[model samples]
Target: MQTNNSVLVTQQIKTWLEQVVIGLNLCPFAKRPYKQKQVKIAISTASDDDTLLQDLLQQFKLLENTPIETTETSVLVVTNHLQDFFDYNDFLNLADALIEQYNWQGVFQIASFHPHYQFAGTTEQDPENLTNKAPYPILHILRESSLDKAVESHPDVDGIPEQNIAKMNQLTKEQITELFGYLKD
Candidate 1:
């Protein structure tokens, strides 16, 4: 399998997100519906990163009665891997699941460092389109030379530290799967 620093960074972020979700007592999917005030983040190398997405949904399902269906969802799909960089078929499948199965009507907020970045099968015409071309306000994080660069480029009123994109270029599928599963038990 291909490997590089980008993969490592992706793994780190995924692991961090999973840990945060559980640590914040947001596990067992059923609990998510009531915590409407929480600004939860779900990160992945790609939106189609099945290992991460499936685990998230399964965990959410564990605690809530809401159908595992996604609905008008607002989420940030962070990645160094852009739409053209990965398999298009996988991306489409991910979108289908989110739109049809999950009932997610909210825009999918995508944050990527790729110049050709685009969410698969998502167009500006779709109500879910939330990107550079769209008019809706978005928070996009991109690659920079350092954490300082990220901060300088993407500033916040609260003085939050800009998240440095990890170089995730050396990870195996098993490693990725293990990382994705690290938070539950």
Candidate 2:
């Protein structure tokens, strides 16, 4: 069901992941799955919260049913609804409730990303916001097993956010603006 636009958006996400994330060592764990072709990117077309929840459930099942080595993770990209960061942020509650609704506790987790991602206690212009900002709203779905392995190997997990903030703070405004422009359109 992926259209041309869906392909384009997923490609853009890949570009961002390569050029900014793995390229900059922002996520030390990302490179492995990406290189092994274990990453699944799906462009969601749901226009409402309920439909979006269903789409997420479907993706969750797809990843769960597939072999771990085949697809270790999935990124559900939403280019349709939840453009507003506040709404997108609030939607995580619903997303989390789905895991409980289906008795999927400890089986999956959803990480949020948005074009205008702003961390709590920070303003919109804060450089640290760049850490989670993406070309579009996305739900990064990861198997709890995979995450457990990743976390076990990464002893400095708690320091990641601080390191990302410091890294983004090192960039000048021009560089940040250029990267943001590349991500958008």
Highest-TM-score candidate:
2
Tens-digit lDDT track for model 2 on 46-119? Answer: 99999999899899999879999999999999989999999998999999998899888898998888999999
The C-alpha TM-scores of every prediction are 0.27, 0.94
Off by over 4 Å in 2: 182-185
Top candidate (lDDT): 2
Q: Can you write out model 1's per-residue Cα lDDT over 1-185, one digit (the tens) per residue? A: 32575456445544443443333222233134225423333344434366545544543333233222332122344443334434533454554464446553332322332223244685423322111221111122211222233346543623321111121223345643453332222
lDDT of each: 0.34, 0.89
Root mean square deviation (Cα) for candidate 1: 15.3
